[model samples]
Target: MQSFEIDKSDLLRIKNALEDNDAELQRVLLQYHTSEIAILFEKLQPDERERIINVLPTGEASEVIAEMDEEHHPAELLVNLTPEKRSEIVEELDYDDATDLLSQLDESDQQQILRDIDQEDASNIRALLNYDEDTAGGLMNTDLIKVNGKLNKNEALEEIIRQSEEMEEFYTLYAVNDDDILLGILSIKDIIKAKKEVTVLELVNKEFVYVKVDLDQEEVAKLISQYNLTSIPVVNDDMKLLGRITVDDIIDVMEEENTEDILKISGVSEDEELSGGWRNAVKSRLPWLVINLGTAFLAASVIRSYEDTAAKLPIISAYMIIIAGMGGNAATQALAVTVRRISLSDLTDRQAYITVVKEFLVGMTNGATNGVIVAAVANWYDSNPMLGLVMFLAMTGNLIIAGLTGATIPLILKRVGIDPAVASSIIITTFTDCIGFLLPLWLATKLLL
Candidate 1:
């Protein structure tokens, strides 16, 4: 067995193999990093990689192939394969992974793969593929143990053992009625604790809850956490057990959702990558950047309107920069906190509004306190009383605005079904900048000049 971590030279060798049309050597040469292997598959046109993928083991091979970024259509190669080969890959994939790949393929391609797969696999994939990618159904594993309530303790254990052989270590067993509605759940520990003589129907807990297939993954995660469930069953309209959302998968969903929100708060889109192509990356960000620019100009225009005040007291212009920075930073902090809360829980408009008022007060009191400190710092440097006063007023104003803007934007976005994080940076910064610049000049005009 040969395995080695690839370095620069290995990467070059893999590249050379693709150049030489050595698909055999290419597959063998590039088994080190799954992501890197995906990237290697990108070097050849899809037809070449498609040919290479055919020779590999189904599971590990499928993982490496799945590692390819969806942006690259080296998958076009996958689309051209025989329906049998396409399905061979699809059938071997886990429900979630298969759904991800299948959703990316064209309608006709998906149809062909579905037609070519086993009926059971096809049904499971279709059931999952039908749901939104963010929902529990899409993210959950359909291969879950479900026991009929009529089963006695011995019968249930036997059924669970048979299912375990099929799916392996299924921690949660859903107890369903004849109508297929979820009644409760049984854990592995619960099964083991039962007397061999006790009926499973008597042993299984009936208080456990479940979620619908269409429920958001975030919500599903909350349900699991709140109830302390190892796994939560997902059901369809008929209450037939469609799947179970496992904690491991829920953890992934939570990380993704939180990361997406964090990026959004920073005025970055989910697609912005540190290593993406310059053109693609810039295009993804440029629209929002341009929007941010427009708002910046709006801020500058406010400063422009008070240019005469700044002209009369050049100190106002100098201190305005500090104001803008303080406000923007404060607003970002508030926005991040609120956005994360909304993401994890059901935050009502009223609750958000109340939070806004509290943040405003918090922002104001803290801003005023920081303003006093900044004013003192500025006055210490310049030996001017008015400079200190200007710093204090501007800092207080900006902090107040930052807290309100940061908290409100995401909440509003949620209400509208837009990602709260989208354009959050641009919105919060624009508000803070506009306020930061204008407030100091306006205060200066009234008090200093």
Candidate 2:
């Protein structure tokens, strides 16, 4: 399908339709997909969004709300919806999506909404809500096609057809025992090719990969990507089938995880929303800035200790900033790579050591190349070979330090059970800054004095 891009004209048309109570509103919206409508909701006022939701069919409305980013306050919109309408929408949503929306509300709101939906659906949603949102259980949907392992080809096909009536789409069939323990998986192709006499257990792929419900969502995502699966079964400790996590859910998890890592690396709290207010912005960011300020003071003290060196040769001031900035930039690059690697998978001791060593070599190569250029510039600018030599040595040494710290700090933090992305950048910045300033000045004092 082609991607839809909403424009100013489209917004104006929608607003006009809303104001005039035009019947054209539904027709205009019908042109867009559910996801596209979700995007449009982000641009509309809450009341306008409510009007739009009320106009759409119940199923489509649920999909639009499910597609919406949490920053848009979908839970609040659900609360504003009339009880009967809210129940209709909730019932239409998949248990996973319904759980996510309801979990964002207060306990009372959740209970009230739960009371209105079908008992079975509400029970499924309640079971999902008990899981941590970052786990496999939270990402899985109870909706799936499963057959008893003893069922023959014809019986399995009949079961599938019966089970599939409530589902919009399915990619795989799970084979389970009478006790609901997962036996294996069967593809539609396998079932179609099987002889009438074959049982589901005989046709099932016993080696299929599956994840425990308590597994971290990141690990679940990795397994899905590694195996190139459209969906994977989720089970409990006893291998009892619970639900299946589809590729669509894994895609969302990957996006959320990568966004969270980027935010944490930038010293911003992951909880801070892009659409949040100024007060929330300050509340989320001020603590990190204060910590950074403390680190800056440490660098300043290093500079203070070399007061005489900088005073005697004021030219060192300009060159020092260049050295420090280069070191900080290089460290940041190394830190980004290391943190991303850690996120993708756990590293063994040997692998982690090799990573650090590889980064060290990279730092040396980059440092030597930049050092030569900077040294040439310094020599030409000041007409002093001694000053140039000092610049070369300081630049090379500081970058080496930058590389070592960048790669090593994250690994150490991760070992200590800390999130490498959260603490690595701040710590690496301090190291780069302090060493960046100390290196050039100390070298210049001894060599160029």
Please tell me which predicted candidate would have the highest TM-score against the true structure. Answer: 2
Tell me how candidate 1 scores on lDDT. 0.77
Instruction: List the pairs of residues colliding in candidate 1.
Output: 46-77, 153-199, 153-200
Question: Worst lDDT window (10 residues) for model 1?
Answer: 1-10
> How would you encode candidate 2's per-residue C-alpha lDDT over 4-72 as one tens digit per residue?
787898788788888865367888888888998898887899999999988888999999999999988
- lDDT, candidate 2, equals 0.93
What TM-scores do the predictions have? 0.83, 0.98
Off by over 4 Å in 1: 1-52, 66-77, 80-84, 192-197, 271-275, 348-354, 365-369, 412-419
lDDT of each: 0.77, 0.93
* Per-residue alpha-carbon lDDT of candidate 1 for residues 381-428, written as tens digits (9 for 90 to 100): 989888798789889888998998888887877888887767567778
- Report the number of clashing residue pairs per model: 3, 0
